[model samples]
Target: MGNFAKGYSMKDRQFWVIVMSLGGASVFVFAAMYSVQPLLPFFTEQFQISVSYASLSMSMTTLSIIIGLMVLGFLSDRYGRLPFVRFSILLTIIPFLLMPLTDSFAVIIFLRFIQGFAIAGVPAAALAYISEEIHPQSMGLATALYISCNALGGTIGRLMMGYLTENKSWEIAFLCLAFFGSIIFILVWLTLPKSRNFTIHRRFIREDLYGFWLHLKNPYLLLLFGFGIILQLSFTGMWSFIPYYLVEPPFLLSLKMISFIFLAYGLGIIGSPIANALANKVGIAKIRTIGVLLLVGGILCTVSTSLALIVVGLCIACLGFFTTHSLTSATVSRTASHQKGLASSLYLVSYYIGVAAGSTLLSPIWLHFKWHGIVIITVLLPIIYLFFLNYTLHKKMP
Candidate 1:
C-alpha cells in the first residue's frame, strides 16, 4: 500500500510537470503565430509596405514552421526527442532578439523564419513523449492537456502582443517574446521528467523510410491528414483576419478590444481537456461531429459586425477548434503504430500546410470581399468539411 501510494504520488507529480512544460513550450508557438498579428499595422507603416507584405510576418513564420515540423519530425525518428526539442527552441532565441535590431524588412522576415523553424521542434516530440511515457489509459487526457497548453499559450501570446502593440514598437514585441521563450525553456528543462521509455534513435537506412509509406497507405490516415489541413485553414483564416474585421467600420474596435477576443481562447484550454474526456466517454468520432457543428456556427457569428455576437461566436469557435485538434492529433498517434514520430510529423505537416494556405490565400479575400466576403468563403470551407467528414464517417460505418 505504501509503494502504491508512492507510485501514485510520483505519477501525479510527473503529470503536472509535463503539463506545465508543454504549456510553457506552447507559448513559443503562440508567440511565433500571433507575435506578428498585432504588429501588422506597425510593420506596414515602418516598412512602407502593403497589408499583404506586412502579413508575411505571420506567413514567413508559419512557412518556416512547416519546414521545421517535417524536418524535425523526421529527425526525431533518427535522434531522440529531447535533443531536438532543446536544440530547436534554444536556437530560436538569437533570431527573436535579433528581430528588434534588424533594419531591413527582408532581414526581419528571414529572422522570423528562423524563429518559426525553431518553434517547430517541440510539437511532434512533445506529443510522442507524453504518449510513450504516460500510461495508455491516461493518454487521452494527457494529450488533451498538452494541446490545451498549446491553445492557452497562443491565446495569451496574441492577447499580450496586442496590448503591447497598442503602446510600444513592433521591435519591442519580438524582443519580449524572446525573453518569454528563454524563461519557458529554462522552466521546461528543470521540470520535465527524463524520458524512461525513449530509446536511442537507430540509424535509418532505406527500410527505416518504409514506415512513412506504411502509415500513409491507410485510408483513414489519409482522411485524418486532410481533415487536419482543412481544420487549420478554417482556424487560421479566422484568427489571421480577426483584427482586421473587428477594427473596421460600424465597429472600429481598437487593437486592445480585438485582443480581448483572445480571452475567449482561454476557454479553449478548458474545453479541449473537457472535450477529450467527453470524447473518450462517448466516442471520439461521435463527439467530433458535434465539434464540427461548433466550428461552422462560430465562423457564422463573425459574419455579423455585432460585437456581442462575434464575441460569443469566437468563444464557441475556440472550443470547437481545440476539440477537433485534440481529437485528430490523438487519432493520428493511435492509428500510426509503426512510426509514430513520422506519422506525427505528417499530421503537423498537413496542419501547417493549411496554415500557410490560409494565411497566404485569405489575404486576397480580405482585400476584395472585406469581412462578409471572407466569411462567405470560410463558411463554404466548413460546409465542405462537414460533407467530407460525413462521407468519411459513413465509409467507416458500412
Candidate 2:
C-alpha cells in the first residue's frame, strides 16, 4: 500500500509519477472518446447520411459515457480508484480493435458506445483520486495538468484519425488508435501508484443513491453543474460542425487541411494551467467569468468570413473553454464535502450531456442556418448563462 499519512506534493518524486500516470490515463480516455469527431464528414459522405445523423458517431459515445460515469463512479467509491482507472484504459482498446473488422456503420456506432462507457472509468475516478492523494497546495496545478492532457489527447486523436482517414482508410485509423491505446495502458498500469488516501466505502445502494440526491440538492453544485453543460455545449457545438463548414465554404479545404485546425486544441493545453495560476492570484470565480467572456468573444469571431479570423477564433475559443473547464472541474472537487467521486461523476455527466447535445441538438441549426445560426445560438447561450452564474453567486455570498 502506498503511504497515505501525508499527501504527495510537487517536491516529491511520487507526485510526478501519480500526476503523469493519471494524466496519461486522461489522454487515452479523451483520445478514444473524440477520435471520431473529425470523421463525421467522412462518415456522412461514405454512409450517405445527413450531417446530424453522421454526428451519432460522436454523440452516441458521449451519451454512453454519461451512463458509465454514474455506474463506474459509484463502484469506484465503494471499491477503489486505481482499479477503475486501469479498467477504463483496458476496456477502451477493445472497441478500436473491433471497429476495423466491420463495415457496418451501425456496428461501428454500437462499438463506439461501448468504448465510451469503457472510457468513463478513468474520469469517473481520477479527480477524486487526485483530490485525495495530491497535496492541497498542489491540487489545482495537478488537476490543470490532467485536464490539459485531456485536450492533448483529443487533439492527437482527432488529428491522427483525420489524417489517416484522408490518406489511408478510417479502418486503418482505428487500428493505429488501438495500438496507441495499448501503449498508454501499459504505462498507466506500471506507473500509477495505489491510492493511499482512498477510504473504501462499503455503503448500501440506497445510501449511495441518497448521496447522489444530496449533491443534486446543493444549489451551488447545481450552478457548477449547469456551467459544465453550457461550457461544453458551446465548445462542442462549434467544433462539431466546423469541419462541415470548412469543407463547403468559399475557401474549400481537404480533410488533411482541416485536421490542422485541431492544433487550436493546443491552446487549451496552455490555457488550463495558466487559468489555475491566475486563479491563485485573483480568484477562481473572477477568472472563470473572464474565461466565459473569452469564449463568447471567440465564438463571435468565427462568424467572420476570413479564414485567418476563423482559425484565430478557434484558438481563442479553445483557450477560453479549457480555462473555464479546468477551474470548474477543480471547484466541483472542492465544493463537494462528501462523496467526491459521486460529485465529480455528476459534474461529468452534465459535461458529456452537453457534448451529446452539441453534437446532435445543434444539428438542426447547422442544417438550416449553417455556421451563422450555430454562432448565434452558441454565443447567446453562454452570455445569458454568465449573467445567471453571477447572479447566483452574488445571492449566495454573505
Candidate 3:
C-alpha cells in the first residue's frame, strides 16, 4: 500500500509484494500466450492442417496481442495500469476454458486471438508500472526478475501442455492451464498494490496521438523498437519450429521429450538478472552485443546432429535472447521522457509482431529448407541487425 516519492526499494516489504505479484501475474500471462507453441504438431494432426496452418494458432494470438498492446497501453495511460493488469489475467482464462469445448480449428484460432489480446494488458502496463513504482536503484533487478518469470511461465506452459497432450489430451492441457491462471489471478488481486506514481493523462485523443507520433519519430527509440523485433523474430522462429524438427529425422524426439527442451528456458530465468547486473558494469550496449553474439552462436550449434549439442545450443540461445530482451525493454522504459505506457506498448507491439512473423512467416523456410534453412535465416537476421544497432548507437553517442 506504500507508494513513497522515492518508490519501493529492496528493503521494503511492499517492494517484494509488488514484484512478486506482478511477477506471478506475468508468469500466467506469458504461459497462456505461449503454451500453444509445443502443441503445433498436435494441432496439425488433429485438424488435418498443414504445418503453416497449425502455426496460425500461435501467430493469430501474437497478432491479436499486437493490436491489443496499442489500444490497451493507450487506455492504461488514460485510466490506470492496475486495472488492465487485473483484467488481462481474467480475460485470459476465458479462451482456455472455451478452446477445449470446440472442435473446429477456426473456432480455436479465433479463441486464441482473443486470448492473445487479453494477454497484452500485462506487458502494456506492467513495465510502465515498474518504472513508475519501483525505486530506480532496484528497477533493473526488478525488471529482470519479472522478465525471468515471463520465461518461467512460457517454459511451464509448454512443458505442461506437451506432457498433458502426450498422456491425456490437448483439451485437458488447456483446462489445466485455465485452472492455473485462476490461481494466479487470485494471488494478483490480493497482492498487487494500487499505483501511487501514475499521473492520469486526461488529454484529448489528438494529444495522445501526438505522443505516440513523437515516440515513433525519435530515432533512438525507433532503434530500440527495431531491436525488439529482431530479437524476438529469431528467438521465436527457433522455438516455433524446433518441435517439428525434433520429431523428425534421426532425432525423432516425442512431444514429451520436446517439452523438456524448454528447460533451456530456465537459462533465460538466470540470464536476465545476471545480464542486467553485468550491463550495470560493462554498459548495456556491450552486454547486448555479447547477448546477440551468443544468440547467433547458439543457433549455429543446432546444426550439429547430436541431441546433446542441440539442447546445449538451445540453452545458449535462451540465455542470449533473454539478456538482450531484458536490457532492451528496461532501456525503453527509461528512454521515453513521457507517456511511458505508450512507449512500452510500442516496444511490445514490435516485439510480438516478431512473434507472429516468426511463427507464420518463417513457415516457408521450414517448408523448403527444413531445420537447416531455419538456422540460416534466424542466425543471419539477428547478426545483420546487431551491426545496425551498434552503428546506430555509436553515431548517436558522440
Candidate 4:
C-alpha cells in the first residue's frame, strides 16, 4: 500500500471526484476500444473481406495494447499516473476523430492501432492509483465501481454503434462516438485529482525485465496468469463471432436487434459482485469452478440452432466471464508479495493476449467448422483451465 495520509476518507469530496473521474476515463477507454465490435459486419461488407480477415480490425488493437501495456507500465512508474491518464485520453481522441474520415480498411486498422496504445495508459494507472491513494477499506468498492463503469462503457459503445449503424452510416456513428469521448476527456482533465501516493522513479529496463521474469517464475502467479488468458480467450472469441453467427443463417437479426442482445453484457456488471457475495456462501475454489462450468454450459447452449437459446447462452457466458475474471484478478493481487503493479500488468497482458488469440486464431476454426467448431474449441479450454487452477491451489503461493 502506498502512502495514504491520515484523515483521507472515501466520504471526502476528493475521493468521490477521483472515483468518478476514473470511472469516466474507463468509459472512454472501453467505449473507444469496443466501439468497433458492432461494426465488424459493416466493415466486412464495405471492405469486402472475409470474417477472419475482418477480425484484424479488432485483433490489431488488442495486440497493440499488449505492446503499450509493457512499455507504459514502466513509464507510468517513472512519470506518475495522472499525466499518463490525461495523455492517454488525449491521444485516443485522435484515432476516433480520424477513423470516420477514411474509407480504407488499412487506414481504419492503423487508427485503431494508435487508439490501443493510447488507451493502455488508463488501465496501467487506474488500479495502482486507487490501491495507493484511496483508503484501504474503500479500495475494493472503488475498484468494483471502476470496473462497473468499464462494463457499462463496453455495453453502451456496442449498443450505440449497433443501433446507429442500422439507420445512419457507420462513419456518422464513429464521429458521434468521438465527440462523446472528447467530452469525457474534458471531464477527466478538469476533475481528476493529482496523484499523492506515487513517487516517480527512473528504474532501468533491465531491472523491470528481471522483475517481470521473477513474477512469471512464481508457480501460483503463473497459473493465475494463464487462467486470465483462458477466460478472455473463450469470452472474446464468442462475442466477436456471435454477431456473424446471428446475422447469417437460421437466426437472422437486424443490427438493432443484435444490439439489444449485447445488452447481455449488463449481466457482467452484476456477475462479479454477486459472485463475490456467493464466495462467502460457497468457497472460493468451488465458486471459481462453478464460474468455469457456467462458461462451458453457456457455450453448449449456443451450440443449438434456437435463437432464444443462443441469447440465453450469451448472457450465461458473460456472467461466468466476469465472475471468474474478478476472482482471478483478486487472487493475483493477493498472492503477490511485492511489485503487485507489475504482476497485475502481466496478468492483464495475458488476458489481452487471450483476446487477441481468440478473435484471430479461432476465426479460422469458425471458417472451417462454423458454430460447432467455435463451441467445441471454447468448451475444451475451460476444462484445461480447471486442471491448472486446481493444481495451483495444491501448489501453494509464496
Candidate 5:
C-alpha cells in the first residue's frame, strides 16, 4: 500500500499514481460502455431492424447497469471498496473480448448486459473511494479530473469505433478495444492503492439499512436524483439518434465524419471544473439552471440544416450535460454522508434509468416524426427540469 503521510497526499509519487490510475480506469470504463453507440446504423442494416430496435444494443447495457448499481452499491458499502472495484474491471473485460466472436445481435446485446453489470462496480465504488481517500482540500479537483477522464474516454471510444469499423469491421473495433482495455486494466489493477479509509462491516445490518432509508427520504437528494434522470434522458436520447440522423438525407455523412462529431464531448473536460468553480460563487442551483438553458439552446441549434451550427450545438449540449452532471454527482455524496455509497448508487440508478428509457423511447419517435420529433422531446425535459430545480432550491435553501 502507498504511504499516507502528508508528503504523500500533497502531490507526491503515490498520489499521482493513484489519480492517474483512477483516471485511466475511468477512460476504459466509459469507452467500453459507449463504443457501441457509433455502430448503431450498421446494426440496423445488418440486423434488418428499425432504429428503435438497433438502439436496444445500447439500451440493454444501461438497463443492466441499473441492476448492477443497485446490487453492487449496497454490497460495496458492506465489503471493502478495492475488491469490488477490481473484480468489476476484470469481469467487464470478458464481454468486450468475446464481442469479436459473436455474429448474432441477440448474443451481442446479452453480452453488453453482462458488461454493464460488471462495470457497475466502477461508478458504484469509485466516487465513494475518492471521497474516502482524497484529501478534503483537493477532493473537488480530483473528482473533476476523473470526470474529465470520463469525457475523454467517451470521445476516444466513439471515434475509434466509428473509424475502425468504417475502414475494417465492427469486429476489428471490438478487438482494438480489448487490446487497449487490457493494458489499462492491468495499470489500474497494479497501481490503485488499497482503500485507506474504508471500514469493512457486516452486510444488511439494521443500521446500514436505516442509513439507506434516510437517504431515500431526504428531499434535497431526491430532487437532485430527479434532475440527474431528466438530464441523462435528454442527453442520451439526443445522442442515441445522431448517427442515424447524419447517415441519411441532407447530411449523408460517413461513419468517420459522424465519429468526428463526438469529439464535441471534449468540451466536458473543460466544462466539468469550470462548472464546479462557478458553483462556488453562483451556487449549484443557479449553475444547474444555466446548464439546462445551454442544453436546450444546443438542442434548438441542431434543428438547423448547417453542419457547422450542428457541431457548435453539440459542443454546447455536451458542456451543459457535464456541468449539471458534475455538480449533481458531487451533491449526492454531500447529501448523504453516512450513506455515500448507497446515495451514489441511487443517483446512478436514476441516471441509467433515464438513459435506458430515452434510448429506447426516443428512437420510435425518430421513426415517426424524424429529427424534428426528437428535438421536441430533447428540448422539453431540461426546461421543466430547470423550473423544478429552482423550486427545490428555494424550498431547501429558504
Candidate 6:
C-alpha cells in the first residue's frame, strides 16, 4: 500500500484513497490542460502567427475535453469507475511526454486534443465516487479538497511554467510536465483503491444513450447544466485572456511578475471548502447567489490598471468562481438517483461546451473590444445564472 493509502483508515477505502490521491490524480488534468496557457504568446511570437491563431492551443484542448467529459462520464456508468479512471490516467501520460518532442503547431494541437480526452478520468469519476461511497456528511469536505487540488495545481503549474518559460524554451515547460506526470502516474496507480460502489454491466450503446437522454430531460438537470456553462464561460474567458491583458500596455508586467497573479488561484483552494460549509448552513442556492454577485463585483473591480486593484479583484473573483463551481458540481452529483456517471457527464458537457464556444467567440471580441470586451462578453451568462439561482433559492430545492 502507498503511504497515503495506508494513512487514512476509513472503511470506505475508495473514499479516503480518493481524498489522498486527488493531488496526484489532478496533476494529470492540470498539467495537461493549463500547462499550455502560459506558452500562448511564446508560440505566437516564435511562429510568427496571429494571436488569434495561437489561441488555438487553448481552444483545441477544450474542444477535446468536451468529447472526453461526455463520453468518459457516460462510460463510467456501465463499465465501472476504477477501470475508466485508471485507463484514462495511463493513456493521458502519453501525450504529455510526447508534447515536448514536437515543433509543428498542427501536431502539438493534435496531441493536446488527445491529452484532454485522456485526462477526463479523475474529475468525472471522482465526483461519482464521492456521491456513491462517502457518507453524506463527509462528502462536502472530500469534494472540496479534491477541487482544491485542481485549483492549486492550475495556479502552481501556470506560474511555475510561466517563470520557467522566461528562462527556457516553451518545450522545457511541456517536458517538465512530462516528468512530473510520470511520478503522479505511479502514485495514482498505488493510491486509488478499488471502489465498493462499483458494478460492471454490459455496454449497450442504445440503452446508455437513452439513459443519458432521460437524465438530461429533467428541467432541474437542464438548470444545473446551464449553471455549469455559465461557470465555465466566465472563468475560462478571463483565464485565457488575463496573461495577454497583463503583458500588453499599461500593465507591461513580466512573466515572473504576472505569475504572481496566479497566487490568486490559491484563494480558490480556500474558497472551495468555505463555500461548501456555507452551503451546508445557509443552503446552496442562497450561497451560490452570493458567489455570483462576488464574481460580478470582482470583475468590475479588475477593469482598473492599478496593480493592487487588479490583484485584489482577481483574488475575489477566484474565490467566488470556485465557490460557485463547488456548489454546482456537488449538487449535480447528489441530485441523481442513479447513473451519477451520466449525470456528471451531462453537467460536464455543458461545462466544456462553454469552454469551446467561449474560445470560438473570442476572435471577434478580441478583434473589437480586447480584454474588456472579453469580460463583458462572458459576463452575461453569469448574470443570467443569477436569475436562475434566485428562482432555485425561492423554491428551496436541491
Which lDDT tens digits does candidate 6 get at residues 171-212? 777677777777777777787766765656686788778878
* Best candidate, lDDT: 3
Off by over 4 Å in 6: 1-15, 388-398
Residue ranges of candidate 5 with Cα displaced over 4 Å:
1-8, 203-207, 395-397
How much does candidate 4 score in TM-score? 0.95
Q: Report the error of model 2 at residue 243, Å.
A: 0.2
What TM-score, over all chains together, does every model reach?
A: 0.92, 0.97, 0.97, 0.95, 0.95, 0.90
The alpha-carbon deviation from the true structure for residue 3 of candidate 3, after best TM-score superposition, in angstroms, is 6.0
- Summing lDDT over every window of 10 consecutive residues in candidate 1, give the lowest-scoring window: 1-10
Q: In candidate 2, how many Å is residue 310 off?
A: 0.8
| Prediction 4 global C-alpha lDDT | 0.84
RMSD of each: 2.6, 1.6, 1.4, 2.2, 2.0, 3.4
Off by over 4 Å in 2: 1-3, 396-398
In order, candidate lDDTs are 0.76, 0.89, 0.90, 0.84, 0.84, 0.76
Against the true structure, candidate 5 has what lDDT? 0.84
Better structure of 4 and 6 per TM-score: 4
The residue pairs that clash in candidate 6, if any, are none
Per-residue lDDT over 1-398 for candidate 3, one digit per residue giving the tens place of the 0 to 100 score: 34488689988888899889999999999999889999998789889999999999999999999998888987988899999999999999999999889899999999999998899999888888888899988877788899999999999998999999998999999999999999999999998988999888788888888989999999889999998998899999999999999999899888999999988888999989999889979999889989999998999999999999999999999999998998898789789998776787788889998998899999999999999999999999999988987887788754
Candidate 2, residues 158-246, lDDT tens digits: the string is 99989999999999999898898889899999999888888878899899899999999999999899989998999999999999999
- Which regions of candidate 3 deviate over 4 angstroms? 1-3
Tens digits of lDDT, candidate 4, 1-398: 22357313577777788889999999888888888887777778889988777888788999999999988989989989988888888898888778888878898888898889998999998888888778887777777778778888889889988998898978888888888888888999999877777777677889888889899999889988988898889888888888888888878888888888889887888877777778768877888988998888888899788888988988898888788888888788988887889999999899899989888899889889987888888889888878867976777632
- What's the candidate order when arranged by decreasing lDDT? 3, 2, 4, 5, 1, 6
TM-score (C-alpha, index-matched) for candidate 3: 0.97
Task: Report the C-alpha displacement of residue 288, candidate 2, in angstroms.
Answer: 1.4
